[model samples]
Target: MSDSTDLPRFPQESSPGPTGPTGPTGPTGAAPTRPGTVNGAFWAFLAATVISIVSGLLVLGERDSLADAVRRSDAKLTAQQIDQAATVAMVAAVVIAVLIALLYLLFAVKLRAGRNWARIVLTVLTALQVLSLLAGSGGSWIGYLSCLAAVIGVVLSFLPESSAYFAAARPVRR
Candidate 1:
């Protein structure tokens, strides 16, 4: 007889074959409510990034007018300083937005695919986001909302169905 290792790998070889009648097939659709906490976190971060980008672009577009206004004022700030400061702020905003977006995207993929380490990262990120809401400017209602969304996402992603989906999607370790 051939060795077991030489045999073709098959489910039937390891388990009993179907003997009972099959159940009716249900309509195919996406699994509802998989741990989308990761998705939520990603979206929240994305929104924040977009907001920063748009705000930055707006500031950049109005830089000249703002500088003019400042120069017209009694403050009499130098045009060079005004231009330099605006440029610096615009560049910083763009860089920060890009970095946050990239990081969120990476976490989103991991959470979507159910990587174990992703769960820890997501949790930490969520907590930090929530803390930022409290620590940041009180007038930033948007930041508060975004932080709330992240918290919700993390909670949803940790649900049983979500966890199972992630586990199944994760790579099978040899």
Candidate 2:
């Protein structure tokens, strides 16, 4: 026996008949087709990503307001300090947003490929994103639109048909 493996081997022609406890071994099941709901979810996630990028760009126009808010939150800071803080905050925000958007895109592709874990992770991310959007905005139309798309995506991803399709897709491990 090769040192690489010592497991028992079964003859290919020795499949048991239906009299076996697990029934006769037969041909493997084919992969499940991608469902409409998953496609809808994928599109919704893409829409949310686009809306978020637009919203971030629009937010750049409000730098003055951001600085004022930062000053208010810390009265002792000098004007230069306030500006630096605001700039740092904005840069950090953009970086984090970009990372989150990329994550959404990655999971969306994986979910479309019938990865069940991707669906679950995407669902949680969507919930957090929607909650953050709501908590951070008063009535920003862009934020609302993104939230709507994210909610729709998560909803579609968990629907019965999507769930069944995801469940039906099983990965083979080496």
Candidate 3:
């Protein structure tokens, strides 16, 4: 038998096996590179989240005006009843806005990681926002801005490169 040092050393014994750091496939198999389009979509979705928060705060700022409007619209409501109605509406608005922002953040992160399901969910949400605006929901300019960003994000998610990246990552990704 040969001496220990005379035998093939660790580095010479093997380069990289199937379980190497680069993985079984090859180099770049560890993680698919995120395309520019997917990255852009991520940023757009993040911007939409920020816009939604700001819009929610602005709506909250108009709480007094909302109460006045409700008071004017219904002549039969007592002062306490009007206040309660305004409070309920405000709470509903806050809940809806928070839910929307949370969804955007969750899906945006997954989309950046090349999740096709996230892309689809984000697309559906964008459609809903557009439809809401078109249905005369009395959206403010800020709402329109948020919708525009979401639309851009969804569109980017469907680009050819983005689609390919998502597809490739699905097989190797967990």
Candidate 4:
């Protein structure tokens, strides 16, 4: 007679059933959708930057005695100072344009990717732009119109559609 302890045990699968320790179930939800506010803001920012750079370049290209005279009265700069200022302004404009373009691209990517931080960043940036437009006024025809256009752009960007989009993109509480 054989002992019970020597009897066969439960059969196991050849491949070893449940070979590893059990793991908890994964998160039970999908990620949210991207918003359009990011896209619109990105486009507007890029376009504004490009326009500013192009205009600056064109203005710098036209620098002559007329430009010097204009700068002398408008900026209280001497002839030599005007020349220096023009060069500085041109370089600054191009650099700023590139930087703004890069920022816009980053903003768009972050907004689309649902980074959440982009919403606050975009809001602050747009608000700063609005303030700049108001503070940079010079009462000149071109200056006034430029500022007005900026104001309009900023205002339109706050429309319901854009607002909703931005809200949706905001970070969620876990």
Instruction: Give me the candidate number with maximum TM-score.
Output: 3
Reference-based TM-score of each model: 0.59, 0.75, 0.81, 0.51
Q: What is the per-residue lDDT of model 2 for residues 47-136, given as tens digits with 9 covering 90 to 100?
A: 998888887777677789999999889899999999898888788778877887888899999888778898899788877767787687
Clashes of 4: 0
Local distance difference test values of all predictions, in order: 0.59, 0.78, 0.86, 0.52
RMSD of each: 7.6, 6.8, 6.1, 10.5
Tell me the tens digit of each residue's lDDT in model 3 across 1-174.
767888675544533323422234233356666789999999999999999989987877888999999999999999999999998999899888899899899999999997899999999989999999999999999999999999999999998889878766765654
TM-score of 4: 0.51
Clashes of 2: 0
Model 3: what TM-score?
Answer: 0.81
Residue 22, model 3: Cα distance from true site in angstroms: 15
Candidate 1: tens digits of C-alpha lDDT, residues 115-156: 768767867977876776567654255456556656666776
Worst 10 residues of 2 by lDDT: 17-26
Rank ordering of all candidates by TM-score, starting from the highest: 3, 2, 1, 4
Cα distance off (Å), candidate 4, residue 70:
8.5
lDDT of 4 by residue, 1-174 (tens): 989999889876343222111111123222334335445555554455455445445555655754566685776667677777767766776677667756755764565454546645655765665576668643344334433443444444566655554444342324
Two-way lDDT contest, 2 vs 3, winner: 3
C-alpha RMSD (angstroms) for model 1: 7.6
**Higher-TM-score candidate of 3 and 4:** 3
Clashes of each: 3, 0, 0, 0
